[model samples]
Target: MEYYEGSFDSIVGDLVAGNRVPAVISDEEYGWIISISYPYKSESGELLGYVCADISMDSVVRDRQNYLLSTLLILAGVTAVFAVLYYVLFNYVFVRPIKRMSGAAAEFVSGGRDGEFSSSIATLSVRSRDELRLLCDSLKRMELNIREYVNNLREVTAEKERIGAELDVARHIQSSMLPCIFPAFPERREFDIYATMTPAKEVGGDFYDFFMVDERHLAIVMADVSGKGVPAALFMVIGKTLIKDHTTPGRDLGEVFGEVNRLLCESNSEGLFITAFEGVLDLGTGEFRFVNAGHEMPFIGRKNTFRAEKIRPGFVLAGMEEMRYRAGVLQLNEGDKLFEYTDGVTEATDAGNGLYGMERLERVLCAHGADTPQEICEAVKRDIDAFVKDAPQFDDITMLCLEFRQKTPGIKEEEQ
Candidate 1:
C-alpha cells in the first residue's frame, strides 16, 4: 500500500485527517497508473487504516486507440460503397451522352463534305435539356447553312464559266471583224498603213478598220462605243458595219458619217453612242479628207515624232436625230504620217492617280522617231506602257497610223 511514495503519503494524510481523497494520483514506477485512496472509520468512532483502489491510465488509452481503429474501418467500408454508386451514376447521367455527341461530331466531320449530315444527334437532344442538347442543335444549324451555301456556290461558278466561254468566242469574232492583218493594203503601196487595238476587257468597245473604197480612196475608221463588254461590243459591230457600208466611192466623208449616224440612231434603244474619226486619203493627190464626230484629236507625223491636229468636232454619233457632220481637209505630204486614236491614249491613268495627259502623249509620240508606220505605232505603245507601269487599263486603246509615200506614184515598203 505504501509502495508509491508521495501519492501514498497524500492518501495516508487524507485518511488521518478524516478527509476523502477524490482525485486520481500518479506514480513514477507505475508508468501511467492512477489511484483513489480514502480514510476508513469504525462504528465506535475508531480510526482505520487507509483503503485505496487504483486503475491504470494505460488501459484507457488502449481502449481509445481500439475504438478509433474500429471507427475508421466502418468509415472506409461506407466510403467504398458510396464511391462505386457515384461512378455508375455519373457514367449513366453525363459521360454516356457526351460520348455519343463526340462520336457523332467525328463522323460528321469525316463525311460531311460529301453532303452527308448525321441525324443521330437528334435522339440525344430530345432526351436532355442540358448544354449537350444545345450543342447538337447548333451543329445541325451550322451544317445546314454550309450545305445551302455550297450548293449556291456551285451554281454560280458554273454560270460564270459559261459566260466566260461565250465571251471568248465573242472576243475572237470582234478581233476578226476589224482589219487585224499587218499589211492592210499589201499590193498597192502608195503609203504604208498599220493599226493596232487593245481592249481593256476580253471584248472591247474600241474598233479600227482600214480598207480601200476604190482605186483612189483608202478609208480608215477609228471609233469608240459608249460602254464595255457584250453590249458595247454589239454596238461596236453595228457601228463598224454601218460605216463600212455607207462608205463608197464619190461619197463625202462627212455625209458618209451622217448616214451611218442615222442608221445607228434607228436602233439605238440603249441610248448608246459612239465617238468616231474617219479619213479618206487620196492616193493620187496625197489629200486626206476626214470627219470627226466628238473624237480625240489626231497626231500628225511620219514616224514616232508627232503633233496633235486641231479639229472642230461634231456631236457624237447617235447622240441626236439628223445631226450634220463637218468634214476637214489636211494635206498628207510624202513621208508624212497620220496617227489616230481613241481617248484611251491621252486619258490613261497611272497608279498614282495621274492622268497620262496629252502633254505626256505628245512628248512620247515625238521621241525616238521611227521610219515605218508600224514602228511609229509600236513606239508610242511602248512609251505608254512604260509610263503607266503596273497600272490597269481603264479603257479600250486603239491606234491607226498611215504614211503617205508619194502622189500618184506608189512607193513599195519592205514587208513588215
Candidate 2:
C-alpha cells in the first residue's frame, strides 16, 4: 500500500481524458481480476489523484463453462436415443420383411420338401401395405403356375412314351414281312439269291420278294413306293400282296402287271404309286424275262465285272388306268448274275449335300463283283456309308442279287 508503483499507462490515459473505464487486470494471487478506475477530484471538480477498484472473475467464468458442458451432454443423449428408435422402426418395416422374403425364395428355388413349394412363399405374411407385400403375392402366384405346368408336362411325356412303344412294334412287324431268311431256296443248288432292305425311318417304302412259281420258274420282285413311314408301309403291303397273288405259274409278266395296275388304280385313294420290276427265270434254260415300271435298270455281272443293262421303263403302277406293259427278255449264260436296287443307292447324301450317284454305285458293285451275292450287297453298303459319313439316311435302300449257276440235272432243257 506504501508507494504503490506499477505501470498504469492505460489507467493514466483514461484519467487524463477524464473517463471512467473498466479493464481486465492480472495478479499473481488472484489469478484473474477486473478493475474500474476514476479521478478523486475536489468538490468543484478540480484535478486530483485517482482511485480504482478490482474484483476477482474466476467463479463467474467457471459457472458459465459448466452450464455450456451440461447443455452439450443433454443434446448428445437425446440424439443417441432418437437414432436407436429409428433403427428399430426401419428394421421392422423394411429390413426384416426383406430378409424373410429372401429366405423363402431361396428355399423354394432349392427344391424344398414335396409340399413345401406351395407353402414356401404363400406363408410369408408382410403386414405392411407396400410393394414388398405385393411382391410376396406375386411369388405365390408364380409357384401355383409352375405346379400346373409340371402336371401337364408329365401327362404329355407319358403320351409320347406310349406312341414310341407302338412305333417300335410296327418296325419289328415290317422287318418280319421281308424275306429276312437267307439262302431262301435252301434245298435248290442251281442258283444262289440274297437280298436286303434298310429303311431310312422306322419303316421303309422299299420291298423285295422271291418265290418259286413252279419247279422250273423263279419269280423275283423289287419295288419302291412313292412315300415313306406308316402310310407308305401300308401301301407297300397292299401292292406286294396284289402282285404276288396275280403272278401264277407260266403267266406272262406284262399281263400280270397290266391286271395289277387296274386293281391298284381302283384302290389308290391316296394318290400313291410304285416303281416296280419283276423277273421270271427259267432254271432249265437260263432264260430271264422281266418287266419294268418306272424303275432303275438292273446291273448284270459278267466277266468278273458289273454293267447296267438298259431297259425302257413303263408308267408307274397305279399312275393311270389301262397303262400297257411289255416284257423284255435276256439270255443269262452260266455264271452270270443279276443285281437290282432302288434309287436310294444313287440319291444317298453327305454332309456337303453331294449325291452318291450311279457312277459310284457301279464302281463299288464291280469292285466286289467276284464275291458272293451276300458279300456284294454288304460291300456296296459299306462304300455308301463311307461316302456319306455321319449323314442322316433320307430314303430306303434295297438290293437283290441272283446268280444262275447252271440248269439242274435231270430237268428237261427248255428251248430259248
List candidate 1 stretches off by more than 4 Å.
1-126, 302-304, 410-416
The runs of at least 3 residues in candidate 2 whose Cα sits more than 4 Å from the true structure, single-residue gaps closed, are 1-141, 413-416
- Model 1 misses residue 159 by how many Å? 1.5
Each model's TM-score, in the order given? Answer: 0.75, 0.74
Give one digit per residue, the lDDT tens place, for model 1 in 50-140. Answer: 7867787787778989999999999999999999899998887688877877886677666666666555544445367788678768877
Give a tens-digit lDDT track for model 2, residues 1-416. Answer: 21222444535666787666556465445565666576778888886866878777677678878888889999999998998999999999999989998888888876644543546776889998889889888888887887777678778989979877887898898888888898888899889999999899888889999988889889999999999988888889989988899889888899999999999999999999999999999888889999999999999999768999989999999999999999999988888999999999999999999999989999988888888899999998898899999999999999999998887668643453
Candidate 1, which ten residues in sequence have the lowest lDDT sum? 407-416
In model 1, how large is the Cα lDDT of residue 290? 92
Evaluate model 2: give its TM-score: 0.74
RMSD of each: 6.6, 7.1
What total of clashing residue pairs does each candidate reach? 1, 0
Quality of model 2 by C-alpha lDDT:
0.86
Model 1 residue 194 CA deviation in Å: 2.1
